[model samples]
Target chain A: MALDGRIEQAVVAALALSKGADAPPRLQAALDHAVFPGGARIRPTILLSVATACGDDRPGLADASAAALELIHCASLVHDDLPCFDDADTRRGKASVHRAFGEPLAVLAGDSLIVLAFEVLAQAAGDHPRRAVDLMRILAQRTGMPGGICAGQGWESEAVIDLAAYHRAKTGALFIAATQMGAVAAGQDAEPWEELGARIGSAFQVADDLKDALLTPEEMGKPAGQDAAHQRPSAVAEMGVAGAVSHLKDILGGAIASIPSCPGEAKLAAMVRAYAEKMTPVHLSPVRG
Target chain B: MALDGRIEQAVVAALALSKGADAPPRLQAALDHAVFPGGARIRPTILLSVATACGDDRPGLADASAAALELIHCASLVHDDLPCFDDADTRRGKASVHRAFGEPLAVLAGDSLIVLAFEVLAQAAGDHPRRAVDLMRILAQRTGMPGGICAGQGWESEAVIDLAAYHRAKTGALFIAATQMGAVAAGQDAEPWEELGARIGSAFQVADDLKDALLTPEEMGKPAGQDAAHQRPSAVAEMGVAGAVSHLKDILGGAIASIPSCPGEAKLAAMVRAYAEKMTPVHLSPVRG
Candidate 1:
């Protein structure tokens, strides 16, 4: 499927899975509101691409993996916007979940999304129990641990931290899970794909940092530069903005190079190049303007 | 195996599994601290009893199941104590995790425990993939729903709330999961044990409410009366203290009645009755000269 088609399919499926039975009407509405008008499905797209490259015969399983990872990403965003975290009033050019619903519901909503990610994986990993279990492990590690996204958030409170560890766990972990899960779904037993995922995942995090430091909220469709407010470390913190950009290109190159051993490496490389070009500092200006 | 002996063995094993290869020193230390000096292993005790009553031949499986539920409960307590939530300074008469380890590491510690709960279950249910999967579903629902404990906290912000649904989802869900997991681990079919679990689960929630409202922090080893501070509804809210006491008896009776259909029903009932009595208002009073 085309990247946009994959993104659309994943988003719809993810939103559908989060609805609760006899749940507070506001919780369901808030989940839909946070998911709609859509945030970028960059992670899921990468997942789908990697799965396809790995010879996945089951498109539905691939879609489910993609959707599951995206739900986790979406959940982190909801929590990241809470008053105690980024304290942002808006997301995607609209009211943040906490602002739209109350803080209490928003917290629960974010948490529910996190749980729903696992639920989606459990229900969706049909005939791939082992892969599903592996996916759960990878996702859980990213969502919870030292270098995981939760740890990434926790790092904000520290006076000092390893910048590389922060970005890798906070942002890169989910991306890695996405790529790994996609490959696992495709029944590929290859090792190179994991390294490819880590490299690409890091590249994506660097790209996100570049956008946060350089792009407008309008361009990103989410608050920008809020990382500085919490005194959290970013690539832009360690490296100058221009230096971060160069580093991002290098990361992308490494990610692409790691993929050649897999089948259809060129197509995956092309996808990386196109996405990188579209998301770089130069491209962000027109969207902001 | 005796219930107390089973609990001791399970606690040791569960804590041992907390280690990770790439775990940060601070995160690891925080985890150790959070789980050690364990509380009354009440939920697990109840779970093991229920499992034994249900014809579970292996006591080891019951221990594992109980440990998983306790880990979940402990993890939730850690998160709930964060500045974003209760902002408590103490738990079990010691420094709360965020107070001890700082906010970031504390958060990661809690997140780790939550993931660890599932990991424990997944590892234990190695041969019974279906039962293991079902355990994940049950815990996931209890920990992350409209009526889940997390959602129960969210209900504090609503203008009106459903006491029964909130209590059932929050406290009752884990208890239910514990019973069901124990039974499943012991090879009981889903249908009968689920009903037995529901009864015991309701009683557990009522016991928790009794402790929360009527007991002092020194007596309970956690902060008391925070429920009123948050304006959240409780069994105390829907029914008077006397009514809550009566409700506990009724729920316990139902739980015991459901047990006669299973093996070792009398012993299980006796243990449950003893536990419920120990948790009663008079039993929880602060000591006096």
Candidate 2:
């Protein structure tokens, strides 16, 4: 199966585990809505690609880790769009979870998905107990406080912000989880993958900054220029649009170069290059200028 | 050290793990505020007591599990008090996290704590990998969907409710985790302890129903009659105050009887009897009448 297909299947199966006869239909529907028709599926793709690069010895564990990462990403998006936060109306060209299904269910759905991520990892532990523990640690570290996505969100409330730390926790953490967890799932050392993950995560954040700065809501499929409106520290805000774009290029280059020495190093590098091309803004073409 | 003291230390240390120079001060404060001065500390107490009854072989893992359970409980309370949910202004006789730090911080705090729970377990895995996996599974099952606390919260949104399933998910799930995780942490078979946990959990819920229906907000240190106001399914609503009180007694009796044959079985029974006495409403006293 294709990477996206596997990820989708794993996600569906994970969510299905929660579907009881007595479960609130609305919460289940909201969860389905949050997951299906995902954004880029970039995190899971990176995860699986890395796992495959490292032999992909445990396909089931890899898929579960990838799905869990994606679920956490989706859940963060749902919560971020809540009225208290970004209050975003549209996500992936549709109404945000809260807009579509009241705030309470949105909160519940997000919470459920977070728990589901751990549950998926735990259930997959039957085959590889140690790897399961490692996956859980990687996911949890990247999702929680200090240097995780939660800290990334918490940084917004602070008076001063460190752009690198903020971006890392907000965006880089999950990417790190992807690469590290992918490696771990494939029975490889996780440390070697961290640099590559960090680079990709940094590049992704810069690309996001660029899109937020330059795109319209219709073009982005979500609210644009939100960073400025929210007074959130952004790469574009810290380094001007052109500078941010240059930084993105530099980071992607570093990402491609940072691929660890693995059985599938060449393929991993190619994957990074492909992501770099995809993330590069089309309007930045010299001919357009 | 005593169980409560150990739990307090573990909780303090767990929250401390999230504290960094860059962490949002408000978020750190809110996380601390949510956990400290905790109400009852009943879950962890039960967990530790069960672990003790089962030999307390791995004290660190047991403490971590106990702390993780309490953190999950604390996170649930923070989310439950959100404006979109209960919108309660007070918890444990003080302002709720959302009320004190705003909704965004409250949400972030809750998310961070949830991740912290698993992170604590993962960190403790070095000493006992298999037990850590078991702890993660137990915690996830009790906290997430299908049968976890998330499912418990989701029950509120349903058109029709199954009181048994709802109470089990909402209340019984954590108690089950407490017993099962305790046993797992102590290297004992967790299944034997499930009945005891279930009975204790059911008893606690019934007692809560009685308190909510019969007590005032001041007396409860939090909003009373919330279940009735929210139209949530409650034992008192289903069985009435007197019947619920009777049910509480029955559950307590079953809890005492359900003690597994552990070395500390007598001590565990004594603990249950003490809780039963504590849960019995004061007004029910013949002298008071």
lDDT of 1: 0.71
Q: Which candidate should be chosen as best, given DockQ against the real structure?
A: 2
Off by over 4 Å in 1: A1-11, A14-17, A226-242, A260-264, A281-289, B1-21, B54-64, B83-85, B102-107, B123-125, B208-244, B281-289
Q: Write the per-residue lDDT of candidate 2 for residues A126-175, one digit (tens) a residue.
A: 75788899999999989988788999988888777776678878888999
Interface RMSD of each: 2.8, 1.2
Native contacts recovered, each model: 0.29, 0.73
Candidate 1: tens digits of C-alpha lDDT, residues B19-132 = 555445577678878877888777787777777777777565567678878887887788778776678898877999989988656655766777677666656655556656
TM-score per candidate: 0.87, 0.96
Candidate 2 per-residue lDDT over residues B13-54, each given as its tens digit: 788778888666778898999998988899999999999998
Real A-B contacts recovered, model 1: 0.29
Which of the CAPRI classes, incorrect, acceptable, medium or high, describes model 1? Answer: acceptable
RMSD of 2: 2.0
